[model samples]
Target: MPADAAAWHAWQAHQHQQRQRAAAQAAAARPSWTRRLRPAPPAPVRAATLVAALVAGLAFALLLGDGMGPGLALAALPAMAAAFTAARAAHRKARPWTLAWVAGCAALLVIPALRDSAWPSTLAILCTALLGALALHGSRTWPGVLLSPLGFADAAVSGIGWAWSGLHAVGRGSKERWLPVAKAAAVAVGLLLLFGTLFSSADAAFADLLGDLMPDISLVDGPLRIVLFLFGALVALTAARAAAAPLRWDRIEVAPGTPRSRIEWALPLILLNLLFAGFNAVQLAVLFGGYDKVLKSTHLTYAEYARQGFWQLLWATLLTLAVIALALRWAPRGKPGDRRFVRVVLGVLCALTLVVVASALRRMDLYVDAYGLTQLRVSVAAMELWLGLVIVLIVAAGVFGARWLPRAVVGSAAGAVLVFGLLSPDGMVAERNVARFEETGKIDLAYFQSLSADAVPALDRLPEPKRSCALRGINDELSAAGDTPWYATSLGEYRAREILRERPVTAPYEVCSRLGSFGSRIEY
Candidate 1:
């Protein structure tokens, strides 16, 4: 940021000249082709063609039989009202693509709580909206300013709502551009939906035979729509600000005097996936178990939902922000060889990815065994790092990689990690099998519920390298033996030992995968 502006300018100029030469070469190759197909599509035809596309997209969305059930299609009342709102119409590109978006929402509409089936239909709804948005904005018939926002909400109900906005704004012709790399998420979502539909069908059969290993699939609810709107507002705001600031095309064409700010790229990359993952995680959390793990024992109420909402925002915000910072620093950018402090970041990222996966597996642990903060924190810390790294790589690699952006970032990330781990605190991976033997500690059983069964013997067989807070609490219970003093005495230990001796170690992996407990301890 501080130095090497002159070097950047030289590098940028060279890159721009090369780009011009390539364009010239390609144009020369296609001289006759250019005559047959105008280099730029006409604005009117672009608009009118979209009118037909809107019709097709709407028709496709309506035919989607799963996410939007035939019976509940009428439930799209609120959305239809919003889409057709006078305010919305006045603002969006007055093109047919706008109507197509509304129609997609209308066709893909589902009842609020009746999740129905959300695979291909939802995917279709999303895809159609995206295509319509792309078609509208690409043909100069209209600008994205008036419509991208409502179109976001209207499109989001199908999932990938934010991305649909980005894609439409980016324009279809710019397939070689970096922005649509964001839309790969929409593509991924679509693929997931298609596969998910098959997976669910097979899973249903499997459930009948194997007993529902997977949670029943569910659709995003209305409350989620509200949250998405808020999230979309944030994304739109960020993008709008970026767009409004006139792109010093000169600066971009030639990397600025400042090394291309990776944050310019990294923040959007990390944020997009973070938003998607969090949204889906929330969906899984709510639909699978009815949001009970977050609920206190007394009752299920709006207060509980409200309380959970607070924590969700708190956690998502903290984690998402942390992810952004990590990407900005560790992920690669600029000339192919510029491997700065990347390894340090990768070491941190690898460790964190494992943690996220574990946290996900252990969500079930919380529900069944009352798992607490230690597990949650460790899990999220790991997850945030991993997600931040992966998303950054994929987006840059996929979008910017047109010029090898992804490869440079990834190769450097791996190389940096390998070199750093050997030189410093980072390593490929430290298998603690033996050192684990050296570091032992007393821990509360609740903390171990989600831990592997082998861990029990390991703990019992090792010394107290660290005193677990849970163990301390359990010890406190045993320590005080006054008439009503709280402590786990020999009696408590004896009882616990007996319980442990009789209890089977293995737990259902299904239960381990939910939002709460990983498998702290199984109670039959």
Candidate 2:
């Protein structure tokens, strides 16, 4: 009997050794990239992640049902918290730049709570999402900056796998441990329902209080709420996974283009510079020589000349950026003289492009002065300004080393967006138009009608019927919106409601009709 038992133990030890060898062979057979991928998190972390995702989902379903407002910030809180928790659990340190990007995302999310303008709100939401992705898996390289959003796809796949594995684990031994707790919860729920129903039936006020506390889930809203819940859970899970194990986008190598001779690089750029100089000279002449000289030379009105060339100049400036990029790619890199030559030529091109940027902006300014300010005009102008800033940063990068250029450019863009939101662009448009109207006795009432609640204060400054007429659309919207919930409240909407309540639009239709074409002009 002792000899038989010894044989059985030896056989079991041999089997365990064979299983370990097979596992090692399987691991070795994996592709290099697959081997580099992060392993699944520990069981405790997985359980925590699942709980966090469910909480985030619940927050989203509750807070995000309303329009864009403070509720967006509230809904995003759980996901951000889960990301931080997962990162900490995985022993990943948050870099300073990543933290800054996260802070910027938080600030951008708050913009929608402050302003009701469609453009700013939309931009804020979009920028926040991009920034959030960058916070998770940001790279300092230009390629990485451009490709960081791809992490979302990776995270989604990883998150789904993580969830499936986690659920399977829970179904194994975890069920037995949780069974008693589940039973206890079921009993507690039963008791609460019985007692709550009896109390509610006994007191009218208690029933009203209970009704007010509970969410009104209708048949149509039920599916939508479920969808929102699922979406939020997915987002939280993906974000946590991304924070724990960020994709190494910078590791994807890009080979440099073949270096070119100095003549091949310098000649075309010199000619481009001359062309730019000639155009800039004409622009300068038109700028300093006034509208009379433009009329004499082009036989066109100031506004017409400004309008005709601004779009073309804008395109030229954008193309110049592309040209500079390509030129740098093929730039000579052999000698000291070659480096200097590259810098001088590309610097000249960038300088000339700056002139073009200035010309485009000047033309836009002249056009805006001629006509009233619109959302399109303001948006284009802001874009032009940002592009010019990019060119300036390129020049700086050329002078200094370009190691920081990619991240700097991205940071500038985010800063520009933040500044744009803080400035309240819709308010700026309204104020500018109002000032123009006061100066020239011309106003585009139809444009004013399209402005959001952010423009209310400026529109309130208008005289008599024009003011009421300008505010009628916004007022009607606010009236129809009825009462806003606290979570869904926005500063712009609240202020507009208050202003309208104090001084409602009085006989807007009659006044607007009496003014006829003078009140609102059709924009061509």
Candidate 3:
């Protein structure tokens, strides 16, 4: 009888081994892409994900509805914390630069809470998102910088599956432990209900206190709130999952362009360089010769010439950058002379392009002086300046080697954006225009009307009617916004409120209408 039992156990073990071997073979036969999905998270990670999701959901639903203010910062906290926690749990060591990127993202989220201008706030939010993607899955390669947006898209699309997996893991935990906890929770709820109802009925003050302590839940908005909660939860879960297993975008390889002979590459660039040189020579002559020379040559007013050719020159600068990129790709490297020739032609082209950039900037300066500074003018000038910086970086790479060029370019751009936001662009514009007004006794009252609350301090410097006219739109917007919750208040809005309260717009219409026709009218 004992022998028979041992024989039966042996037969079962052999069958089990055969089944396992078959399953392994089937898995190996599956497509390569199918194997790329990460394995299911462990129980501890699943539990942490669930908790983080709940926190994110509550934060988003409660704090994000008021406006773009401290609420944004508050809402981002849980997701950031969860991402860090997941990284630690997965035993992933974050690079030092990644922390800097995260810190930058955090600072960006605070920008909206400080400034009320649309462009600054918009840029801050957009930059924060891009930086977040970089912190999560960024690589050092140029391709990685270019492809960071796609990483975010991939995470968002996979977030639902990640959330479901987490929830399922939590649900599959031990029933016995949860059962007793559930029973205890039910009993506690019953006891609270019974005593709370009796106490409320016995004393009106108790009922009032209870009502004040409880959150007000509306039936009408319940569905919308639930959707918001789910969205936040999904976001948190996906971020945690992504941090645990980041996509290696730097590993992607790109084929270099076909190499060409020195003549093939050098001929076109040489002609392009000649064209650039000729244009730059004329620009330099006009620059040094003053508006009289421009008037004689172009038969146009100085401002007209400045405005007419500035946009074209900017486009030409951009195209030259692209041409340089293409030229470098096909540049000959077979001989030392070939390399030197490539350098001379490209270097000359770059130096000439710098002149074009300078000319474009000079033209914009003249235009601004003749007319007045506008948001568009300031923004374009900044862009042109950055493009010039990019060219300089390219030149440095040509001399010093280009291994660091990609990251340096990306870092410079991010720094430029941060500086732009911190500068308070709208306020700067207002200050410039105000100074111009004081000097020439000419202002654009209508243009001032379009500025945001960031310009409040500058506009306050204006006298009487001009001040009242420039501040009317901002005043109206603040008044319409009413008394927002503390979490939704911006520094710009708060200061504007205080200023307007102290010196309210008295006789706004009469003073504004009288002075409106006096300032310079901006055509575009």
Candidate 4:
């Protein structure tokens, strides 16, 4: 009986072994095996990262070390976007949401801080794209909830780094997370103050350094703008093509079959950044506050400034190119998170904006007597508030997000005004005036000229003495700085008060004048 039991156990063991062997053979015969989606890591290229960092440092020295504030600020947008894009791509299961976030950040940079625009179409696009990417990519945290508020967070009283860093912190939070932001803010402020101090000293020591080099050298052939514009165009094309490409699940971030050597990856980017940094440094040394420098010294009122603006634009284009080149290089060539298509579209849009804005900026300073009552009363800030808001909203809706936002904002603002008019004590007389200006530019003139009792009361309410005094100050400034010659012939009755009285006029006369460009004037 014991022998029979042992034999039965041996037979069972032999049967189990045969089954295992059959299973192994079946597994080996299977083709195109796949793993359930899992978290992955970026390639380990330590040397490339180090090289990129070194190159960025050199760029900081060449460009940002000088006393240019706005350039640095503008440059930070693309730079941060590039870094975010690269970092997000370094992962194996690359997130599409990260690309959306990057685009949103880029859009935010374009939103003029001084303008009163709504979240621009560009901003909306960025936000929507980012949100979509995040949604598709599946990250844990909402980045905009934390970062978007930074725009409004800027105020002198907000944080120590607010003055320097631009990102005003509300207060301290997770020390590990907040520490980098705080330090970055401090460094920015420190560098700005230091540059301002050094520039002040340099200007006093080397007067020639303050002058425009273009006039002296007559370096006419080296506009560099055409090259820049063309380069920008190419980048834009690349981005467009890439963005046009699809975002398939299979196309997500995965390991490269043959990884690039670190030095090889970084060399092009480092050198490009260095070139940009140097070019921008030269631009800073020459600019006189504005992109253009009006040189009255050469007996040249030829708006020597426009030339300067052209040069600045040229450099801006070059710097933009350098940044993109760096971004492409540092990007894991052929990696998953590398949204080559999305970036290409953005690059084109960026170039277009730069060209349009630079053209407008060049035309701005040419207006004659622009410092007078008209320009002062209707400030750029006021116009920008409405126009920028509208542009921003529309752009966001049409280009980046749902196309309904622009319609909603426009409808809302108009509806509010209409409702206010129906309920107002003034019976919407203000609307009448607004309409008249847009249509006829008469400005309630007939109503006032009829000697309406309300007109005189309204004029008196304006505090004429203070108004006249301010107008006089404006006149004096215009005389000294304006391009147009004041003409008594153009003045009408009430507008020609001081000049007519001539009663030992201690201040300048108040008279409406036209704007002009160069040696020309546009009389009304």
lDDT on C-alpha atoms for all candidate structures = 0.36, 0.80, 0.77, 0.34
What alpha-carbon RMSD in Å does predicted model 2 have with respect to the real structure?
5.9
lDDT minimum window of 10 residues, candidate 2: 36-45
Per-residue lDDT of model 3, residues 380-418, tens digit only? 999899999999999999899888787678767777777
Q: Candidate 1, which segments miss by more than 4 Å at Cα?
A: 1-128, 131-340, 368-524
The sequence of per-residue lDDT tens digits that candidate 2 reaches over residues 169-285 is 455434444567669968998999999999999999999887655444577777888888999999998898788777777766678899999788788889989999999898887
Error of 1 at 114 (Å): 13
Candidate 1 has a TM-score of: 0.25
Candidate 4 residue-wise lDDT, 306-368, digit = tens: 433533554454455445434443454464444443243334434343443444344333421
Off by over 4 Å in 3: 1-44, 174-224, 517-523
CA deviation > 4 Å runs, candidate 4: 1-126, 129-133, 136-251, 254-274, 287-524
Q: In model 1, what is the error at residue 109, expressed in angstroms?
A: 11
lDDT for model 1 comes to 0.36
Best candidate (score: lDDT): 2
lDDT of 3 at 80: 80
lDDT of 4: 0.34
- Candidate 4 at 198: error in angstroms? 78
Ranking by lDDT: 2, 3, 1, 4
Q: Which stretches of candidate 2 lie above 4 Å from their native place?
A: 1-44, 170-220, 514-524
Q: What is the Cα-based lDDT of residue 384 in candidate 2?
A: 90
Give each prediction's root-mean-square deviation over alpha carbons: 24.1, 5.9, 6.8, 27.4
